[model samples]
Target: MSVELSVGKKVSVTVPGSSANLGPGFDTLGLAVGIYDTVEVEVIASGLEVEVFGEGQGELPLDGSHLVVKAIRSGLAAADVHAPGLRVVCHNNIPQSRGLGSSAAAAVAGVAAANGLAGFPLSDAQVVQLSSAFEGHPDNAGASVLGGAVVSWTEVPVDGRTEPQFKAVNIPVHSDIKALALVPSFHVSTEAVRRVLPTDITHLDARFNVSRCAVMTVALQQDPSLLWEGTRDRLHQPYRADVMPVTAEWVNRLRNRGYAAYLSGAGPTIMVLGTEDVAQSLLDEAREQGIRVLPLEVAGPVEVKVLK
Candidate 1:
């Protein structure tokens, strides 16, 4: 039997935004940046109520179909608990559909909120699993759940009828490393960008990406200098360039100047990971071309609090 949450019980959740692919790691690697979205969930006596502010104010749905609401219900089910009604308020700072993992962050905020309301019944791994299921891949979701950097993977059930298992392990990013995001004004659908990728690639390219993925893991932990080489890739990004010409142009521009820049997620946002800042003049030039520059530090895991 599900335990009923008390009316007036409230929980607040803060989850960070993330960047995935980080070049060669493809769907395997992700990093949580300082950008955040905060959601507050309160159990009430009657019907559901949701309020949105900041980033997704007018556009996002305010009903049960909302990703956050769905995730809350999923979390409550997993915890064997129920809320008679909920009041959810979201304060979003992450840019939507700009390769910044806004969707994953929302999912994390919802799951984390549910877990908090349930008196912390879910483990970190369970939280990761529930939140990641929303994305069909764990990279972005895992980073938001576990924070810092994460290496994640999925487990397929032998029966093929059961849901795939999502798992992630946190990685300690080198302290000196920072993230620089060059965000474009327009939104790009993750699905639309993914459709442009070819169905197959040569063994040589596969081998090349594997080596770079290995390099990236080491660079993120031990040697910041290896970042430039580690971020090199022959997969997804190349196929995506034509679709996001401005993002592609800026990525090439920053990389040519020796910064380790890559397309963030399924992007229109280009992300740079490095120990030092990119030159101001170049940043100014990107701004002149209408790109929004955000410099952020690596962030910690999602934080949740049961409110009085």
Candidate 2:
């Protein structure tokens, strides 16, 4: 059954950007950061409208084609409701295609707004599931919705014919641990990056990643210092190094200097797990090299506010 949604009521949502595959936890772990993207959605009369600011002003779609609008419509439909025209204003601080989960934030914000307009028909888990499905992966979606640190994985269904569904848990992190992102000016397509990876891996490589992932999980919970050794991986990064040589270069450089560094999601953005002071120094150096970087804290969950 669908709830009766009111017109003209305003809802706003704030979502945090996420860095996925934090070290060896490929396709499984994510960290929510301080970078944010906000969307204010309101029911309107005739047609959909959108205004984009900051990151993708001229690049993003001005109509229903926008990811935010698409997510709202999808959520509303899932709840068995028809969408009236919506007026959406977005202020995006997270850089798109920088492995910062900008797309995940946009999807979550839209779903949150739609849920509010529909009298809160969806739960947080449902919203996260929808958002993850929209992004075609769970790591970024899980972190954007649940915040802090997220671990996600999929299992096959009982019927056997259907695709596996993902489940996630939000875990606590040490307060001192933070993220430093080095985002280059160039854009790297996530799809393009994935295409370069091999279809299979050796048994030794699989064992190596699993052992490191276990260490990463525990290190994030209680001892971040262990991350210097725990973040080492043999699964995805080695095979796909050529896709983003600069990103790999920096990761190797930092590892040589005894720091935990990993590719933030696919490519072109490298994430360093360290304290603010240490991360800040790297950010400064990146800026000097004409590369942009942002030091971010592990953010709390997403927030929603209703306008009076």
Candidate 3:
């Protein structure tokens, strides 16, 4: 049996943006950044309504087809609760399609909102699973749900008919670690960037990434100095350099100068993970080239509050 949420019920959810593939742990490591998106949802009497503000205000859909709305429906269904209607308002700070996990943040916010409206029926793991299913991978969604840094993986069902199970564990990030993103003006499609990767890779390259992934875990937890070596990869970044030349150039430049920089997700954004800020000259140079630089701290998990 389904329970109907009261018409006046309202909840507010704030979820942080994420940076995924944090170097060699491609599709496995993610970090939640300080940038956030906040969504307010209310159960109403009759129909669906949506309002988007800030980053994607004019371009994003204001209807049920919106990603946030879909996620809310998914969450409500999972909780066996129904809302007669919904009003969703999004105040977005995360840049859309900029490899900053804006979509993942939306999914997290919506699901979190639904859980709050339902008296918190879902567990943290359940929220991570539901949010990650929208992305087919747990990296971004997992970070937004669990916060700080996360190591995540997916389990495929043997029958291939059931949805893959998404799981993640929060890993403590060293206090000195900080993130700086050099965001390009143009948007890069994650799917398009992914399609460019080869169908297969050499075992030697795989081994290199595996070692770095391990190093990254250690570096994130205890040793910030190892960040340079930890962030090195022989897998995706090399191949992706061609399509995003400017981002490739900046990453190379920073790395050559002894900074740990890499492509952020399927990105035009080059992210630097280090204990201190990038040199001002480099930031100025990037700005002159129209790249927006954002200095961010590691963020906490998504937060939800019941307003009514």
Put down candidate 3 lDDT per residue, 12-120, tens digits, no spaces.
9999999999889889999999999999999999899999999999999999889999999999999999999999999999999999999999999989999999999
In the predicted model 3, the residue pairs found to clash are none
How many collisions per candidate? 0, 0, 0
What is the C-alpha local distance difference test score of each model?
0.95, 0.84, 0.95
* Clash pairs, model 2 backbone: none
Per-residue lDDT of candidate 2, residues 27-131 (tens digit): 899999999998898888668879999999999999878999989887887677765678999999999898899888899888877777776878877887777
Clashes counted in candidate 3 amount to 0
lDDT at residue 265 of model 2 (Cα atoms): 90
Residue range 203-305, candidate 1, lDDT tens digits:
9999999999999999999999999999999999999999999999989998999999999999999999999989999999989988999999999999999
Worst 10 residues of 3 by lDDT: 268-277
For candidate 2, what is the lDDT?
A: 0.84
lDDT of 1: 0.95
Report lDDT (Cα) of residue 249, candidate 2.
88
Report the lDDT of model 2 for residue 196. 81
Off by over 4 Å in 3: none
